[model samples]
Target: MSLSSTPPNTSTPIEDPSVYLDDPNRKSLEIDTDTHQGPALFRWLTLGMEYLIGAILVALIVSVSSNVVGRALFNHSLPWADELARMLFIWLVFIGAAAAFSRYEHIAVDALVRRLPLRLAHMLYLLQHLIITGLMMVMIWGGYQVLERSSGRSAIMNVPLSFISLSLVLCVIFIAAVSIWRMWVSLNVIRHPEGER
Candidate 1:
């Protein structure tokens, strides 16, 4: 992909790969999942979550690397590394799930929707998002119940297993919020004929 920054007085001819100059300050981009404009709090929360997940990933990598080097050099593995990796992975799975859902990156069959008429397609899209929100709601409740029943500590780290419960709850809540927002936007799209998406 080609990208160029134009000088204040100069304008480049539009050619080659398509470019979207929607936001003047470049706070967000057309190619980014942040293009879905919503509440400021929601956007900031998602942005913060993305950064938090990235940090977790980096920590996981460092933990694994240190553990491996320790094992090879001193013939001893850092027991805490295993638990750290496991916990980080658990958090990653739940946290990354929200971003994926918001960006519509989840696997889905779209051929049927693509074939439908504009109105029907939007309706189906709204219904799909609503269903996703409902499912995530269920998951939140079930996850909470499960967390309530859990009392075990980690085998090596001795940390309470209940710690990861927050991750599950937060992820599902964020996913549900995004689905609801998308459903609202889909309804608006249906009301105003914006030609098909």
Candidate 2:
């Protein structure tokens, strides 16, 4: 006796991820990390950022939870908990953003671009990445200035304020590098749409 609630449809073939590259008309996001295109070092950096973001998130949770429990049960607060949590939260946001950008996971409105010719679409993509790179450069400069001027420590934890600004600078630097690389890829596709892979 078969234990199936309903028979599966075995006639349909599984779609291969590589097929997207072969079809110019396919307008899909590349969500598979196995097929990620980049130098090994860059890929490693993105993976590291993802791991760091997770660790920071866990630390942030623990800090807040311990403080809450202490206040409720012991009628005493962990003074350093709030400051540590805030610092971890800042790191999480910046690192998470960099990881998301590396994977092209950020929200974007590309309906019009999807409908355009492949070369024309890539032209727009190149322009978009150029603007992003420029903005990131400005952010890096501003972050560096802030880091230099931030001489004070956190109120309770005594952690240096420059540590917080360092996160912003590092995040923008990675994002800017990614933007430049993406711009180069877009430029290549514009020059040779048939050679895209």
Candidate 3:
């Protein structure tokens, strides 16, 4: 048996400042108002709100399920439980979707994008932002119209339909904000030589 000894290579990692710089194309554009200098406070606020809503949804589901199970096993049903659960489920879907946008966790098809060159990928990202912004604007306008038209209608709980419709407005507003933020970032990457992402 022969023993061989070799020194392992140890080298310091190189840091690239360009990764920290903003894109040149977007430098002339207005800075994003969404991102403030207050210690990322808004992020935490939004996150808290999102989690609270999620918890409410989960609790509603659990309560509804328990009620249903109790009624089935005991031969007595809570008539309102199903309706209440449905409403909460609706709210959960819309609010959760909106929250996804805020956190940049929404599903996106980027398989082709991943194969593209860095510059092209950036351009595609900018295009995606523009498309999303337009879509959100449409949703906001349409939701407002629907709310106005359904002003007199009421849900099972006698709640105004507009209350439910307002969820669309809230979702659109958040989505638009996220889209604008994305656009701002894309523009910055295009502007400053050192800001390329």
Which candidate should be chosen as best, given lDDT against the real structure?
2
The Cα local distance difference test for each model comes to: 0.74, 0.80, 0.67
Q: Clashing residue pairs in candidate 1, if any?
A: none
What ranking of all candidate models by TM-score puts the best one first? 2, 1, 3
Candidate 1 similarity to native, TM-score: 0.76
RMSD of 2: 5.8
Residue-level lDDT of model 2, residues 37-140, one tens digit each, is 57666788988888888888889989999999999999999999998988888888899998898877787766677667888888887888899999999999
TM-score of 2: 0.83
Clashes of each: 0, 0, 15
User: Mind giving the per-residue lDDT tens digits that candidate 1 earns over 18-47?
Assistant: 223222211111114346566666767767
Name model 3 segments beyond 4 Å from true: 1-42, 153-155
Ranking by lDDT: 2, 1, 3
Residue 37 error, candidate 3, Å? 11
Q: How much is the lDDT of residue 117 in candidate 3? A: 55
Worst 10 residues of 2 by lDDT: 23-32
